[model samples]
Target: MAAAAPAGDDAVAVDVAGVVKSFPGVEALKGIDARILRGRLTGLVGPDGAGKTTLMRLMAGLMAPDAGTIRLAGVDVSHDRDRVAPSIGYMPQRFGLYEDLSVIENLRLYARLRGIAPRRAQPVFERLLGFTRLGPFTSRLAGRLSGGMKQKLGLACALMGTPGVLLLDEPGVGVDPVSRQDLWRMVEALTGEGMAVVWSTAYLDEAERCETVLLLNEGRLEYDGPPAGLTARLHDRSFRLAGPRRDRRQVLSEALGLPGVSDGVIQGDAVRLVLREGGTPDLLAPFAAETGARVEAVTPRFEDAFIDLLGGGPGGTSRLAERMDPVRLETEVTVSCRHLTRRFGTFTATEDVSFEVSRGEIFGLLGPNGAGKSTTFKMLCGLLRPSAGAAEVAGLDLRRATSEAKRQLGYMAQKFSLYGLLSVRQNLEFSAGVYGLEGRVRRARVEEMIETFQLGRHLTGAPGDLPLGYRQRLALACALMHRPPVLFLDEPTSGVDPITRREFWTHINGLVRKGVTVMVTTHFMDEAEYCDRVALMYRSKLIALDTPDALKARVVTRDLPEPTMEDAFIGLIEAHDADREAGA
Candidate 1:
């Protein structure tokens, strides 16, 4: 592999021309062409099955395109990938390191693979540890590290020999804002040193950080240039539509259905809106009178531009939610945790965490990874017994009546937790029977789920064979087969494209409208805004609990008048650290 660009080649580090990749039943990429130069960060973003991963793999020299050619550092990758392997650093989406090894061990192992001598690697190890702030955790097992720590360690490994080109695939998928910031800092620093980095991310905000962007959709290049060009299209078209905080869902639903509207979502107590061409506040006049809909123009974002570039937003209406029956409960309290604690040996995973969710409420549990949120979720879902205190679901005791309590809720895991070998129809049937549906009832429910989730065509295939969106649909269908009153979603939309996430939330919001209580654990700070109330966990304990707007308000100051959810999150954590330092 060539370390530097060829003479008079415009410093193009990666030259991709007319690239095409196809599967048995699908074409992942079609005639894609892009030039990524040295010392620049390029963002690759697209929808599910939109050829994002395929394009990334092709760019990394891991796969040869069915047609066209890719040149890495003046070398044709298809002709000689091995010749260029030493010049490229690629961090894949899954398991980039050994979980059983320690942080330092992973780095050393990669150093060995890259043939860096032990004495020379020592200084590199120290520098990377300082850069990633992982110096103190070098001896910690990779599996014991938090989500953010693991990503930072993976990035450190990828930079072992200081490769001239780097490809990161969804590195921040399930990482928290704090950790994501760290990862971005490292990538930006590398780019400053003349590294050409291609970052593929689901987070549109992250995409906007790149100097150039290659937007793909349906196997075609939709846009290729500065992200600002796309955002400029949305100038003066974004706004904040506010009413009663309690009516946020209803207001957003109505606003999304109005004519001349392009997009609408609940942000804090208001609906962040984007209007169609020639549309104005005048278009919102219909609902202004009754709901006192206040409108204030706001700056548009990269996500707005991305949505516009692809298509208009997925409408607020949900077909699947329309078919569900309203949940009926005698008590107001749907889920309750009182002084709940969990421990393994002497390590406390969760300590004295207490929260209550009411009927029809969307309760969000959020924190940095390893903050005990997962442990709390497991306790509430009846997967783990709390070392102390009480847990309840639909007024049934989760601690004592684990089976009965489990029957009251539908649990959808972050990984979609489907049986890999089982066909879609088989999985649905198994779920139906497990939930106690029988004979005609079981068959009828399975068929209804298939129709509602649009899984009929994919019935014969395993869930993994489907695209990410369809896999999510199947998982949700399996969870909701029995029509439980409560839903437990663990990062249900993590790593999914914006459109699929909007569709998922539409169904969730619709379910709440029909009286279904939801308890969700999410890494997405923006999604946390959708909750009626949120519980923020830290250091195995509850730190803050409030409405989204209230949480943001606590961090509001003269310098930060309009703070986002991520701002509030990072600000709150910093304040907590400051307070602890002062106390110490």
Candidate 2:
């Protein structure tokens, strides 16, 4: 913070000049310079370990930069932190909300921390509760709220002082489409009212919505301007090639190898491609000719531009595909749930949930947080004992042979659930031992995973100390040490960067081709496209189960004839809620 503003049109909320920050082993920021404006939205967009969080913390005065200065609303944070503290609101990745406290209680606690009296805080509290639509659940404990509600509460707490500059770091992480949309609208409205908002996110789509974008990567600023500056680079380079679902994956694999095809991914029944500078629409003809697929040029998205900036996504090849053994199972259906129910005392988490997954298929479990997706997932993983009915894994009854059923699959929890104290190598060894691998077999698999996931350099470091992407790699490796026939991934790419996400899916698609079955839960609706079929849960019930295309078809209307996965998700949930209200 400096000494007060220069006045009217030149109102700089936060000004950074030649800022540099370094940690023990890595330089987090390098000579960064930018000017944040009042009443404007500035998005901090970058990959994992690219200094988004570091920048947010530095601006919040949580830490002083090794070099340079950050002036907040005309006051220097490094020199006058106490004086400027009340002018800024900061929410880190994990917002500090007490699990045992009620929604209203958390807000009051924050107001007290900000030194606001109850009489003065009441009007602000009322406005926030009404704005976030959390008034009815004021008495609900923070721990009992859904992921979306928790985020809303976090934002409300941050705004307790009604600060001039608001910094939100990945507030939408682990939040579903409907909730993410709501969060975006809330932040946008804040910017409209003269609050300088800096929103950091792993999702590129969110960045594209910002009025101004500050793109950082590896301690350096790549671009600082409107999002259009990046998307314009990939102009006329993006295209969609549509074909039979069976042929698209194969065609995408082949298309990636073609001259000038920089990036390609399986999106619904088509392969979305991003071409290089010299690449042209003519390059897609060869792949389209054989499958009789239709090709049309599509506008490039911020993701396409982002991957291009990162030197393109990983190649569509998987080492696991070359090494992992084939699926060997007794039955075609590897997982089955028949009238499954789970209850915590009198409250039902999941009620009469049922589903089946065939061998080698990619089945998706999708829903908003606390919508029974996790309840159903836990029952399938044998982590929870169902209140009624039964399930089977690899032809083994979960109720009768829980241990045997557990042995048939590998589980990667949402948070990765790794032993943070153990070194990478130690974690791998421990995981192998848990799966009952012998000496030589265990050693070979450990080394194999290290090499496959490029974890050779970080062998001695604790998995928790690594970046979010590397930690994800180690988690997946630990889970797959025994090479189980079935894999259960719970929101595996929730906060991962787009580049790493592509690489993760490359391994997944490769495994599926070799006959390994997969059941995944994800908040990113785009990820639902990877599944063969999706089971959507809402308020402890399975409301829709079908292929991704079919689910989108259900929500089609004249206004939204071409609905995205996100569109289908929110639409179905709304229609279901409307029906429930009508019946009630």
Candidate 3:
């Protein structure tokens, strides 16, 4: 097999041909071929467990391909990594940043490691600091920087020696949208300077911005073309349906059930739907009339095409019970925070934050990285003590009756928190037992969860060995084993693909229908639209709270187009900052 030709006259920075890589029980890549070029951005994209990482490692010369050749700057990297090392800069998803070192110190250290003289390194440092907009923070400890800043610093270090090819793996996963735009600007600038960039991301929107894309799934290359070509496949097959605000979920549920509707998700106050082949607009007319929903033809996005390529629609019946066992609606507020304030010495993580979540509501907490959203979530979950103010979970004070409050909720941390070494079954059993289940009860609960989450096949497999989507399923299963009324999810779908994210949210919607209360934190603005109401936090203060539609409306002005959730979020933050500055 031969690698594809580079676009136009641009030189190929890395050429991969018939690359195959296998782990113990899986073939991560099978006969993969791609030609990444200088002066261009090649998007390496796919769903979870699509072998993107394996291919990246192989290209980076960090791992040997089972079979095939990888050429870096025309040099055989597999056989001569040392020769190719200086020409390639690989930044893994989790960049190795020394927490104790200052930004400039880390850059200088990388320069020294690359055998660059101090005189040569000084100019590189100055250039990187200016490029990354980190000059003011050069003296700050790497650990103290925000998620976006850290990513910039990591990129700066990777470019210390001005490598010809840069491979960045999901650098925008947890960063806010504003910072994400900045990162992309920096990468685009690098490409302008004749450096080739291969960015591996699950974000379809981000992928669409690339010059060319390599779409892989289950170790096989699915599509190798420009993003416009990919999206063009689904032309005129997408539509947006808008109705009464309260009918949003109903609209989504009904749209998914439509015979022609391939896939549907709540986008702001409307439901965006993709139609199956041979499906027509008339097919949706009946539902539209019944629900008072107006349908309009819309342009298909990159996500719509990606989901279509990955087998048009969702699968299997929802595992949740058809109906929720009735809970007494004696109290309206399921979760409440009163003047929640948390301080670490002289720094206030969160200040005077207050909110109330009614029963059966999906409340979203939105903020940029390090905006103190996590601190508020921890306080509400009783994981951290608040310096002042009060919080109650399910009517129980988190500070006072912590145990009682805990029993009323389930929590899924931002990162994978289950024991990686434990088997899927073991983790479920452990969670059940922790919630006080014993003997036959624990066994029954674990089995039920296994069946519910479709984990029977991987029951004996270690959690770490499963795909990211499956790992998420296992984590959710563990969190819900005891069936707590209130659930707290911290960045549940951070790095997952659109398909897996939709699936995860499907289960959450099912649980919500079953009368569960959910509080979630996420950087994905689209996910915020699914919430009944969202609270925007900035600088440790609550800046905006409203339904998604209302929030967007608030942000719309002469300067901005009709706002998406991301625009609304940025608008709210900027407004708050402006107000604070004016007061100061």
Listed per model in order, the count of residue pairs whose N, CA or C atoms clash below 3 Å is: 0, 8, 0
How does each model score on TM-score?
A: 0.96, 0.96, 0.95
Question: 113-180 in candidate 2: lDDT tens per residue?
Answer: 99999889888899999888899999999999999999999999988888989999998899998888
List residue ranges in candidate 1 displaced over 4 A.
1-9, 244-246
Off by over 4 Å in 3: 1-10, 244-246, 315-317, 321-324
* TM-score of candidate 3 against the unseen true structure: 0.95
Rank order by lDDT, top first? 2, 1, 3
**Candidate 3 C-alpha lDDT tens digits along 499-542:** 88887888787777777899999999889989999998888888
Task: Spell out the clash pairs found in candidate 3.
Answer: none
What overall lDDT goes with each candidate model?
A: 0.87, 0.88, 0.86
Which ten contiguous residues of candidate 3 have the minimum total lDDT? 1-10
Over the stretch 63-104, how does candidate 1's per-residue lDDT look in tens digits?
A: 999999999877988789889888888888884789999999
Error in Å for residue 408 of model 1: 0.5
- Clash-forming residue pairs, model 2: 1-72, 1-75, 1-76, 1-77, 2-74, 2-75, 2-76, 3-74
